[model samples]
Every structure is written in C-alpha cells, then in structure tokens.
Target: MKWGLLGGTFDPIHMGHLRCAEEIREIFELNRIVFIPASKSPHKLDAEITSFYHRAQMVRLAIEGNPSFSFSDVEHQRAGKSYSIETVEYFLNKYLKSIEIYFILGQDAFQAIQTWKEWQKLLLLCNFAVLTRPGYENMGLSGALPEEFSAQFTYDEKTSGYRGPTGHHIYFRKVTFLDISSSDIRSRVRHGKSITYLTPDPVRHYIQKNNLFQMD
Candidate 1:
C-alpha cells in the first residue's frame, strides 16, 4: 500500500492542512495519510507550543471523519526533540519495505531542507511529495539542495519525478491553495475572535473546550 506521512507541530490542524493532504493523496494515489504530531520540534524549541497530548488530540478530532486520515504519536513515545529522519526510519523498519512511504511537505518547508538533521539521507530514504502552490514551477531538488548534491537525482519521464540513488523519487506537484493557517487561528482565538470556517467544526469546538490559545 502507498502511504503518505505528514509531520507537523499541528498545534491545531486546520482546513488548509487537511485540504493539502487530501489533494496530495489523490494526486499520488496514496492509500492513506498519517498525521504525526511532533512532541517537541528542534527548530521551535525556544517557542511556546501546545502540549503534545493536546496537539495529538486536536489532530484526532480534526481528521476523525476521514477514514483515509490517521494519527500517530511515535514522537511522543520517544525522548528528546522530534526529528523527521527518525520518524521516517521508524516507519521504514516497521513496514519492512512492504509499503512505499511518501513524505509529504510544503514547498516552503522543502526549500529549508538543509536545516533538517540527516536531510541528505532522509531524501533518498523515501519518496518526497513536495506540495507547491498553484502555478509554481516544478523545480525539484534544484533550489532545495546544493548543485553537487542534487546532481545525484535524475529525472524519470515515466514517474515524472527525480529518482534518487536509493530508488526513491522526489515528486513535486501543485496543490490547491488555501490561505488559512494555524497561527492566524491561534491569534484570533487569543484576541477573543471567531475561528469559524478556518478549521473544522470539531476542531474549533475542541480548542474552545480545552481553552487553548486563551491568554493567561
């Protein structure tokens, strides 16, 4: 089976994330998409974030209706900061090559690939489905990695993706643009504003019930 892995802080999952995952799943013919909430992000260590339990619960509520959407707390079970490489390796070992893993992320996030730990190896480990905004050009692994490093991948006309040394491909495709964001939703809630239409009704209710994002 084809699986898509979407990892994020997911302080609160919103429509944009859900929509992007849905489109990516359809485009790549993925059987299901797993939403993994980071227990602690290395990049956002200094920043304030919601608790892992709460974030995971919010994700569960957000994707409850979608049978193809599932949630995982693998990071929470591990110690220390959450890293994408470890998560990818975990899935690889568990599935034992039975399933094709596609690491789904946004173009902006992909552009900052160098900042991630073991980024070079992670790219070659599994297929990458970088979600670009509508109308963006398909410049896979070019602007994201160094010239010498990216030269390893060759374009395959059949797959329409760049094939890495490990036989995994990096596929770049445009997804429907949704202007909504979790940060904006948090800001609205902190200021006593409505977040309706920004996220699913269940997620909105969950945030309110848990009193998340409210000023102390």
Candidate 2:
C-alpha cells in the first residue's frame, strides 16, 4: 500500500492543505493520505498555536467526506515535541510493514530538514514529498539541501522526486505550486481580514464561531 503522510499544525485546515493532499494522491497514486496535525511543532516556536483538539477537529472537518483521506492523532497521543521520525515509526509498527510511506512537506520545510529531531534517521524511514513553493525551487544545492546531507539525494525528473536509502528509503516528491500558509491565514484572521479563499468554508466558520485569532 502507498500512503502519504501530511503533517502540520493545521491550526485551522485550509484549501491549500486540501489541494496539496489531493494533488499528491493523484500524482503519486497513493492509496490513502493521512493528515497528521502536530501536537507541537518543533519549528515555529513563537507562533501561538491552537489546542490539539481544535486543530484535530478542524482537520477532521476538512477531510470528512473524503474516503481516501484520514486523520492521525499519533503526535497528539505521544508527549513532547512532534517529530517525524517518531510518527513514521508508529505507523510502520502498527500498520503494514510492506506499505510505502511518503512524508509530504513544502519546499521551505524540506529545506530545513536537518533541524528536525533525528533528521537523518527520518530519511531512512519514509520518502519525502515536497510541494513547490514560490522561490524555493530556484534555491541551488546549498539552499535546498544541507551541506552535510547533500550526498544522500538522488533526483528523478520523471517522478519529479528524490530517493535515498537509509536503512529503509526516503523520497522527495515535487508537487504543484500552492502558496497557501497557516501563518498568512492566522494573520488575516487576527487583523479581521477576510479569509474566504484561504481556508475551507467549514474551517472558516469554525474559527469565526470559536472567535479564534481575535487577539489584539
């Protein structure tokens, strides 16, 4: 089985998030796409993230009707910083060992892989699926990859992805451009700006109903 793992804070799930999942499902012929909302992201420590319950609920609403899409509370269930290596290990152990796991990420996030907990070990667990963000693809080797980990990558234009074996295997899938960001959405909401197209209608309504992001 081929599964795509898209993990994020998902403070409030948005259209870009949904679109990216859909696009990747088709592009990679994935059997399922699991949306994993981080309990606490190791990165972005300054941002005021919503509670795990709220974030998980928003993700549930966003992917409700899609059979191919599902939610995982793996990070939330596990204490401490949400690390990809741990999350991937959980699925590998609980689910089918023969399954192919693709860890989905944006180009910007992909560039910062070395900063993640057990970053090198994460590559050995699952393949990476990177979405093309504005100005990210233009970054050369130094910009796209870490100096110490450059030797691990093997590019394949046919799949628009990268592959490397580290005990297991990791793949980097280049996807369609989607500029949507949770930060932009949160900022708009905080400033009382319209977020109509930025997020899903249900999520927008949920945020408004709960009065989230209304802080001064």
Candidate 3:
C-alpha cells in the first residue's frame, strides 16, 4: 500500500493542511494519508503550542469526513521530542516492505533540511513530496535541495523531480496555496475575532468548546 505521512505540531489543523494532504494523496495515488501530530517539536521548544490532546482532537475533527485521511498518536505515545527518522523507522518496521511511505512537507520546510536531525538518512528512508507554499515562485528542486545533499540526486526529466542514490525520490508538488496558518487562527481567537472560515467546523467548534487560544 502507498501511504503518505504528514507530521507537525498541528496546534490546530487548518484547511491549508487538509488541502495539501488531499492534493498529495490524489497526486501520488496514495492509499491513505496519516496526519501525525508531534508530541513536542525539537525546533519549536521556545514556542507555546497547544496541548497534544487538543491538537490530536483537532486533527481528528479536521479529517473526519475523508476515509483516506486518518490520525495517529505515534509521537504522543513515545517519550521526548518526535523526530522524522524515528517515525519513518517505526512505519518501516510495522509495514515491513509491503508499504511505500511518502513523507509530505512544505517547500519552505524542505529548504531547511540541513538543520534537521539525521536529515540525510531521513531523506533516503522514504519518498518526499514537498508542496509549494504561497508566494514561493519556481516550484522545482533547483533552489530547494540543500547544497550538502545536492550531489545525491540527479534530475529525471520524465519524473520532473530528483531521484536519490538510495532509490528515494523527491517530488516538488504544487498544491492549493492557502495563506492560512495556526498562529493566525490563535491570534484571531485570542482577540475575539471569528475564525469561522479558517478551519473545519468541527475543529472550530472544538477550539471554542475547549476555550483554546484565548488569552488568560
């Protein structure tokens, strides 16, 4: 089975995230896409994020209508910060060799690959589908892949992406470019502003019901 794994803090899963996942699933013909909310992010330690239980619930509410979309608490179950390499390793072990895992991320995030922990090994573990963010011109890998690992991939004209030495592929996908963000939603909610169209109805309801993001 072809599976796509998209992990993030998902402080509150919004429409932008859901749109990208849906597009990636359709583009890659993925059997399913799992939205894994991080227990704690290594990079965002200084930032105050929503609780894992709330984030997980929001993710569940965001993708409730789609059968192909599902949520996982893999990171929450594990201790300490969630790393992509560990998540990939866990999936590899669980599925054996029967599953093809595609790691879905944004172009901006992909550009900072060099900063990630064991990024080189993480790249070779699964196919990467980097979605283009709004206001980012040029959707290809020419300026995307870091210089350190640039030698590892050779552009394949047919595939319109790069193929790694270890058989992993990096695809630059163009998805629905929504400018929405969780930070903005939080700010809006804190200021008593309506976030009606920013996220799914269920998620919005969940946040309001739980009084999330409101200032103390």
Candidate 4:
C-alpha cells in the first residue's frame, strides 16, 4: 500500500498541481495519491487563504475522474495550524495495519524542513518524495542526519525515472519547472487578469463565479 501525500493550501487547484501528481504517480508507480488541503497552514499565516470548504472542493474538482488520485480532509478536521509531522502521524495511527506513506513536497518546501515541528520524527514515519524543478539535482540531506538516523540516507538515480515503485526510499524527482503560483493566481484574479492557464478551467470559473479573491 504505497500512498502519496500531496498537501497544500490549494487556493484553487491548478494544472501544475495536477501534472506533478500525475507525473509522480507514473514515475513512482504509486498506488494512490491523496491531496490534503490545509485547514490552516502554518507557513502561509500572512497570506489570505480561502476557506477549507472552498479549497477542499477545488481539490475534489481537480482530481475528479482520476481513480489513483483522491482528497483528504484530515488537516481540516484537525485543530490548530497544520503541521506535516502531525498529519503524517495521523495516517500512521489510523492505518497501522497496511499503510506505507510517502510525503511529496517541492524542493523549496523540502529545503525548509529543518524549521518544521518534530521534523526529525517525520523522517522515521514516512519517506519523502522531493519534487525538484529543472536545476535542483544536488538537493538531498546535508549538514547532519540528526543523531541516530545517519545511515538511513540512501541515494538512487533510478527512483527519478518514470517507472517502478520508489517504495520507502527518500528521493528527488526532477520535473519541468512551471513558475505558476497560487499567490500569483489570486492576485491576478483580484486585478481582473485572466488566469486561464495557471489553473484548471473549471476552478477558474468557480473563482470568478463566486467573486473570490477580489479586494478593495
């Protein structure tokens, strides 16, 4: 049971988000990928995030017809600011019988793991699948591997290829870089700019119809 966890605020799910999930699933032979929209993201506290219902609905719309992709409201159900380590632990405890979780994150996010709460314990609970854009090859663990988990680090280029399961190994997958961002999309909508390609067409329509992101 290899499951991929793709967590984000998902202000509105976009093409890059979908592509990343599809490519990763194909490349890693993942059984399924769960899109977990944060109820309250700890990192983006200053940003004006959409409601949990809106974000979760957008994720549901984005992954609609894909059997291999699904949405989870675990983070939304939890109290306080969302933390990756706590979310991973929730899955571990709930699916203790046959669960193997792989948390997927972008290179930029992965670089900031040192500052996350209980980050060291997270590595032991689930493997990390770091998604890198164009020029980020030399992007793995550095400095030190905590105190007791030094030998757990392993590198393999084959895991980046578009076949076979990466299993429980931590890896970096190089992907086509798209500079599209949720923040930019929100701003565009606020300024009456077209965000057609930046997000899914339906999601764009939803935003416009609901008059979201518009501010004085």
Candidate 5:
C-alpha cells in the first residue's frame, strides 16, 4: 500500500491543509493520507504552540468524513521534539518495509530540510512530495536546495521532478496556493475577527467554545 504522511503543528487544522492532502491523494493515487499533528516542533520551538490535545482534536474534526484521510497522534504519544527522520523510521518499522511512504510537505519546508535532524537519511528513507507555492513553480535546485546536497538530485525535464541518488524522487507538485495560514487565523481570532471560512465550521466552533487564541 502507498501512504502519504503530512506532519505539522496543526495548531488548528484548516481548509488549506485539507485541500493539499486531497490534491496529493488524488494526484498520487495514494491509499491513505495520515495527518500527524506534532506535540512540539523543533523548528518552531520558540513560537507559542497550542496544546497537543486541541491540535489533535482539530485535525480529527478537519478530516472527519473522508475515508481516505485519517489522523495520527504518534508524535504526541512519543516524548521529546518531533523529528521527521524518527517518524519515517517508525512508519517503516510499523509497516515492516512493505509500504511505500511519501512524506508530504510544502516548498518552504523542503528548502529548509538541510537543517532537519538526520535529513540525509530521511531523504533516502522515503519519497518527498513537496507542494510548490505560487511563483515558485519553476524553481530549481540552485537556490532552493542547500549547497551540500545539490548534487544528490538529477533533474528530469520530462516529469519536472528530481530523482535522488537512491531511487526515491522529490516530486515538486504545484498546488493551488491558498492565502490562508494558521498564524493568520490565530491573529484574526485573537482580535475578535470572524474566522468562518478560514477553517471548518466545527473547528471554529471549538475554538469559540474554548475561547482559544482570544486576547486577554
């Protein structure tokens, strides 16, 4: 079976997250896409993150009806900072190397992957489907990729993707860019602005009921 793993803080899951996962599932013919909300992010350690319970619940609500979509709390269950390499390894062990795992991430995250823990090993472990943002559709390795790993990928013009040294490919998928962001939603809510369409109705209600992100 082929699976896609999308991990994030998911302070509050929104439409943008759902849309990206949906598009990738259809485009790649994936069996299922698991949305794993991180307990804590190493990159955003200083940033104020919502509790894991709320983040996980919001993810569950965001992907309730889709049979192909599911949520996992693997990171939450584990201790310490959530790292992609560890998560990928866990999935590999749990699936016993029988499934093809694709790590789904945005272009920004893809570009900063060099800073991640065991990034080289992570690249060799699974395929990457980086969702390209608007205006970054034609981006190449020179500016996007780190200097050290530039030679690792050989560009294939026919497919507009990059093949790694190992057989795993980094597929840069051009997604329909949504102007919405989790931080922006939080800011709006903090100022008492309506976040009706920014996130799902259920999620909005939960936030309101709990009074989350509201300024003191």
Candidate 6:
C-alpha cells in the first residue's frame, strides 16, 4: 500500500493544510494520508507552539469524516525534537515491508530541507511530494537543493520529477493552496474575530470550549 506522511506543528489544523494534502493525495494516488503533528519542532524552537495533546486533537477532529485521512502521534511518544527523518524511520518500521512511503511537505519546507536533521538520509529513505502554490510554482529541483545534494537526482520523463539515487522520486506539483494558516486562525481568535470557515467546525468548537489560542 502507498501512504503519504504529512507532518507539521498543526497548531490548529486549518483549511490550507487539508486542501494541500487532498490534492497531493489525489495526484500521487495515495491510499491514505497520515497527519503527524510535531511535539516539538527543531525548526520552530524559539516559537511558541500549541500543546501536543491539543494539536493532535485538532488534527483528529479535522480528519474525522474522512477514512483516507488518519492521525499519528508518533512524534509525541518519541523523545527529543520532532525530526522528520526519525518520524519517517518510525513509519518505515511500523508498516509492511512492501509499503511505499511518501513524505509530503510544502515547497518552502522542501527547499529548506538542507537545514533539517539528517536531510540527505531522509530524502533517500522515502519519496517526497512537495506542494507548490498555483501562481508561484517552481517546477525545478536543481535550484531549490544545494549542488552536492541536487547532483544525486536526475530528471525523470515518466513522473515529471527527479529520480533519486535510491530510486525514490522528488516531485514538485501545484496544489490548490488556500491562504488559511494555523497562525492566522490563532490571530483571528486573539483579535476576537471568527474562525468558523478557516478550520473544521469541530476544531473551532474545541478551541472555544477549551479556551485555546486566546493568549499570545
């Protein structure tokens, strides 16, 4: 079975995250989309993030009606900062040997992967599906990646992506990315504005019931 792993802080699980995942899943023909919320992001070390429990709850609520979407709390159970490579390794071991793992992320995150922990190994460990915005899509990987790393991949005519040394592919495909963001939703709440359509109703109600995102 082919599965897609989408990891983020998911501070509130907004529409942009959902739409991007849906488009990627359709393009890649993924059997399932696993939402992995980070317990602590190394990239956002200095930023104030929501609690793992609450974030995970928001993710679960956001994907409640969809059978194809599921939640994985592997990062919360693991120690240390929530690194993508470690999370990929965990799923590689959990699933069947024949399973094809796809690590999904936005173009911005995929471009800055060199700064991530064990990024080189992560690229070789699983296939990457990078989401690009409609008007700002950059279809080439040669410039996004550093020279030493980009040299490891060659363009594939069949997939319109680069085939990595490990046989996995790095794809940059345009998806319907909405302007919504978790941070923006939080800001709207802090300003006493409505976030009804920004996120799922369940998550919006949960945030209200729990009195979350009211503080800075």
Clash counts for all predictions: 0, 2, 0, 0, 0, 0
Better of 2 and 5 by TM-score: 5
RMSD of each: 1.3, 2.4, 1.4, 3.5, 1.6, 1.4
Error at 28, model 6, angstroms: 0.9
For residues 1-48, write the lDDT of model 5, one tens digit per residue.
999999998878888999999999988899999999988899999998
Candidate 2 Cα RMSD after full superposition onto the native fold (Å): 2.4
Model 3 Cα displacement at 172 (Å)?
A: 0.3
Looking at model 2, residue 23 earns an lDDT score of 91
Q: Name the best candidate (by lDDT).
A: 1
- What does the lDDT come to for candidate 3? 0.89
Candidate 2, residues 30-101, lDDT tens digits: the string is 999999999978886777788898898889988989999999999989988888899999999998677789
lDDT of 3 by residue, 1-216 (tens): 999999999988898999889999999999999999999899898899888999999999899889999889998899998898999999999889589999999888887777888988998888999987766675465576656667788888888778999887999888878899999999999999999989999999999999999998
Q: Which runs of model 6 end up more than 4 angstroms from their true locations?
A: 134-139
| TM-score of model 6 (CA atoms) | 0.96
Candidate 2, superposed: residue stretches over 4 Å from native: 138-148, 156-160, 166-174
| TM-score leader | 1
What residue runs in model 4 are displaced by over 4 Å at the alpha carbon? 135-137, 143-152, 156-167
Residue by residue across 1-216, what tens digits does model 4's lDDT show? 888999998987788888988888887789999999988888889977788888887788778889999989999888899999889988888988377787899877776777888876776667778888764554356632443453555555655421223235667777666788888898899888999888877788788887888995
In candidate 6, position 5 carries an lDDT of: 95
lDDT of 6 by residue, 1-216 (tens): 999999998998988899888888899999999999999899898998888999999999999999999999999999889999889998888774478998998888877888999888999998999888655459477657778878889999999888999999998888886888888899999989999889989999999999998964
Give the whole-model CA lDDT for all candidates, comma-separated: 0.92, 0.80, 0.89, 0.79, 0.88, 0.89
lDDT of 1 at 47: 86
Give the Å error, residue 178, model 6: 0.3
Q: If both were scored by lDDT, which would come out higher, candidate 2 or candidate 5?
A: 5
Candidate 2, pairs of clashing residues = 127-171, 128-171
